[model samples]
Target chain A: MIVWTLLEWLAWGASGLILAWMVADALRVSHDYDEDVLLSSREGEMIMDEPHDAA
Target chain B: MAQAQAVTETKAQPIGLLRVLGPGHVWALGVGIVLVGEYMGWNFSVGKGGALGSLIACWVIGLLYTCVAMIDSEVTSTVAAAGGQYAQAKHIIGPLMAFNVGLYLVMAYTMLEAADALIVGDLVVALAAGTGVEGVDPKPFVILAISLLALLNYRGVLMTLSVNFVITAIAFLAIVVFFLSVEPWNPGAVLHHADLLAGLPYGWLGVVAAFQFGIWYYLGIEGTCQAAEEVRSPARSLPYGTMSGIITLLIAASLTWYVAAGLLPWEYLGQAITPLYDAAQASGSTGLQVFLFIGTLFAASASANGCINDAARAWFSMGRDRYMPIWFGAVHPRYRTPFRSILFLIPIAVSFAFTGLLDQVVTFSILSGLLGYTFMPINMHLFRKRWPLGSIERGYVHPFHPLPAIVLLVLCTATFFATYLGYGVQLLAMMSFYIVASLWFAFHRYKYVRRGDQFTMPWPRPRGY
Candidate 1:
């Protein structure tokens, strides 16, 4: 009984720890960087310049 | 103007997601998101038809998915972006199609994630009571599973999927182990295939109806393309990974059917919530039972994890194009994850988990998936019509141009009717929901989109336009 209870609480703690870390990291990144720059990365253009027929 | 654009470009490099994934990660993401179905939910086909009907549905739906793989591999190769089908729709068709497809991907995956977490919670509760530990609350466990997976996704993609790869492989191997343990060749083996066989109770129509549940075997296998932006070589890896994942599923699905059908009666097997575990129980070996229990748990976890990854990517892609809000488009500077979108979706998935309406949640997901497949044929047709071969570069091109597209169209229509047979009300409700969502997008969301930014792939201005 004690073991299962302990396990349940540990699971809750672990969930909280991981979530807190992610939230903190997200905040730190936002604080350090500008939103315009962060949103400007639209990739895939110029990926393949030549249309070589793979026939 | 050029100077301003240059400044943004240079600064954007630091916030860009890393291209660190390979074919293995692609295979893991695709398969991990789907392996749970093999453990449960698929046997419902037997309830609709019979053992033989379910098997036929498996092969026929297998053909449908093969078409899906071919068409997806070709289109996804050219449109290498995070949103998978959503990205392809935007480039090939238009914004309305893109918005619909993005919603389909997000809803399908998020709901599936919820269902997976629900199964995990239910399984934990059931197992605990079986061992004399009653009064366990499943709510906290569901939240814990979703939270931990959301954290993994927020931290990094590579680490998240690498863990998915390991757990998914173990879950897959569990099926293989069951098959080998059965010893199909030995005449005296436990399998009562001869007696358990029930020739199609509902006849051919039953077989047709069973098609809906047959999808459980290979659903979400095309989700590999959701990680296109993070792949090292989108062309080679996406096709290879997706094809390999489907083949693995084909083998696993067959083995699962053979083992479970051989052990249990069709009537009970069809309704059994955990068919594989039930089969293990019938075998009377605690070892196999324990192994299957763990496999079910891991499969659900891996699935939930992959769902978080795919749903966030789809939502993030839409936001980046201003289909939703530009605020959701921002990437984390340190982790390079779509932090805002990931966080935004956590509450939505959690709310879905809290609902605990397993059947409704799963039905909604299946209908959404069918809707997404419905768009693939049109997307493929337009892609080829507008940009014929060699007009623009393609990483991979599906051979027999219109054949796959035509076949996919026919199969998708059939599945819709099949779904209608059992879930008619749900199917109509789902369509109405999308219709309402489409109206909102057309009226409100369409104006926010930056039309100039739609053409992200390096290809010619499509031949017609």
Candidate 2:
């Protein structure tokens, strides 16, 4: 029973670490450029421009 | 003039969730959860002792993520922003910490993409070989798989989610079938153990070995959190989605291990590349190998696909924040997806796949992840104290007061040490890369980008052309 419990706890702990690793890595790599530039503007004006209608 | 024109056009659109939280976004979240389970099962199953240790490490690491998800949902409910972790960290820990966290996260995700792509490529070759398809180069197939997956995302989030939902369901069913056939009647051998020093170089080293194996099993549980911007009712969906997804993964992993160990001798089990495949074969079902193969392919693809979508979004969010280049945030006019980021991920993944460095990439991912996980427990402690329980309903309190949290923290710290122990110089090399990259970004921002200059335009124009 002790061995079983130890192993069970061990399995949970190990898997948890791997999950944490993937999440951390995913967070690091996936960034978008357009969204950043759009959000960086101080004025709210740029967000509402009509591209097709204006042309 | 082009910049001015672009800005003018940007001001004309109405702010909406349709643009942000599309169907692809939700599918990406599901894919992320499924991938975490698949990676854990595949990579950690290599060496028994190592696999066992990695699982424990993963469990502790997973708890930290759960805490982050809980806090993140509360913040998202209030803010409703696309920045995800970067936004949350900035809100709580300040900008520098948020930037560093986001930076480290991007690095880890990029490597993971490469690693998963390589694994999927290898699996495809093996599967092809089984069917007597000789001399099929893995590189082109890997590129093809990534391209097809990327194209699926390009069609928009709805199509991607529809596909992922089907894949996730099939993968889950396959895991269930694998589990049922094994029938874990003999629980004794599954739980067997020896002295701490037995079969290892040092006594406590055994614990570390177990942790190394166990950690691989728990790799990607937080993929859902990155999609906070895309989920409807992120507060409700995130906590439930993340916790339930993790619990499902845990149950599946434990059962798979228990049943496999019980049904077959460890020596035979350890030798087989796909232990579940062997288990099915022994159970007198010749067709089970085909089932396992198909299941693994879907599982791997779902995970890789989900990571690509979520990680790209994270990049998009960071790019929007000016931590990364603005080009990464570009959404396809028709698809409303971060098309540029997706494109960026494909090349990086292809490069790694061609190199055939799956183990190295996996190890790199684990190291980088541990570095970020160090913040989660601390983030949780801060979150509870600052907001207080009165502000948010404490739905599921972690049992054992501060003890579980403390144990988690200690174990996390020990795992960091163990990572260094197992990897040595390679670990140092990875850490140095993060430190260097972070400092460079900070310097560049300080030197060039103006402080207190808001990057995002608020929704709803203030009346008139």
Candidate 3:
């Protein structure tokens, strides 16, 4: 059987916790991004808001 | 009347760089360049440190990057320049050091772009061979892909970043699918399989040997900072983008290791360049295997695209600052992009890609990265001392003062030595490049730049601009 070392366990745990934190942050930012877009649309002139076609 | 005039004046100035990026683009650039780590190259660690030992090495490297990303965030937020590390080095260490740092980074990015270009060629042939077609020459296809990406990049930053964002998403999804498709696992079986546990035969020495591959997991996470100049708000987007990218990669690395190792004998997997495809093949889904093969191409292309964009930016920044030829700083009147720098990058990458020396090129790239990172900790301490908390417009100051920077520097130093010992005489290429840079600076560069407005040597005290 493969036995886990303390270091290995800690490493795994850190990865899990960090992953959770990142996912939560991503979700929060995504929501804020949508709201910002909506607000900017209402106010007009969102700064480079349209896509460019040329160099 | 004054406020109205100010708004009109600001709008009237010629648009520079089309500043269209946000946190998402920054995250995409960082994750896109490094995503290939989870797809391939990292399995080589299993050859040196066994499954368990390699996992440990991954943890150490991951921790080092966590510190690097955070510290780099602070630097990017403060400087907010296209030159990235090169720009930060200029303000802190002076022009001579900035020239070397910029040159090394440019070389590293160019080498990576060439290496990924070659990998995309190899994967195309592999995909064809999977369908019983054989002997298709990959050179033309590789050349085509490189040209197309360069042209797209030249057109606009929007094209470059939009494509990267989509491909990066697909690449991540491939990993998830591959993970779920893996065979049912037995933890006991992993230790019992001698082939899967090859690195265990050598003990701790094996773990030390695994450091380079461990680094692959998060190698290019800092590439985002290169886009600080393009972001709408560097102070907010840089840290958010970089931190999210690092943490996401950490998870992807762990789960990838777990699933790939658990599903197949790592000895066989370690030798496979496209480990995910091989693992999918072993999982008995030829369809998924074929899907992953295509995803591998996307992953490599995404990385190469990001590298090309970032490398050109470095060259542009250097040229603008008169560290190199000022002509290289020329922006396209139409695109407003650094057309000259991109033109320079293409020939170098194409010529190198044709050499078929990607393995050696990768080593040199790693050496450049290690050297570049050495400056971070010192800069961090210097920046903190100069502009202590609340004195400057900073984002995400690394907590616990200098401890994170100190740890990252120690880790970078150890990895550099380990890499030197591993590569040995092969690293003469990097040394020669450094010597060439020094000679250029001493003989021709200094005199030209000394009179220019860009020269910031004789390190000035912080003016709190």
Model 1: chain B TM-score relative to the native chain B: 0.96
- Candidate 2 is graded, for docking, as incorrect
lDDT of 1: 0.87
Q: What is the Cα-based lDDT of residue B250 in candidate 3?
A: 93
Candidate 2 stretches greater than 4 Å from native:
A1-55, B1-11, B14-79, B185-204, B267-272, B391-405, B446-465
lDDT of candidate 1 over B43-75, digit per residue (tens) = 999999899999998888888888888889889
Better-scoring candidate (lDDT), 1 or 3: 1
Find the candidate with the highest TM-score and give its number.
1
lDDT (10s digit) by residue, model 3, range B1-465: 765554344333333465678888998899999888888888887877777767877898898899889889987777777778888887776777788889878988888888888898787677667667666666655666677777767767877998999998898888877766553354443223334544464587777777777887887788898886778787899999999999889988987787777666856766667777777776777778767877788889999999999999889888776678776665443354666687678879888888878677777777787778888888888787776776676767777868998898888877766676678675676778798888889788877774445533233456464
By the TM-score metric, which is better: model 2 or model 3? 3
Put down candidate 2 lDDT per residue, B311-356, tens digits, no spaces.
6766776665566776565555434556667766767766766788
Q: Top model by lDDT, which number?
A: 1
Q: Comparing candidate 1 with candidate 2, which one achieves the higher DockQ?
A: 1
**Which digits, one per residue and each the tens of the lDDT, describe model 3 over residues A1-55?**
0222332344345535543543453344334323222111110112352332221
Stretches off by above 4 angstroms in model 3 are A1-55, B1-15, B183-195, B450-452, B455-460, B463-465
User: What DockQ does each listed candidate score?
Assistant: 0.23, 0.04, 0.03
How close is every model to the real structure, measured as TM-score? 0.94, 0.76, 0.83
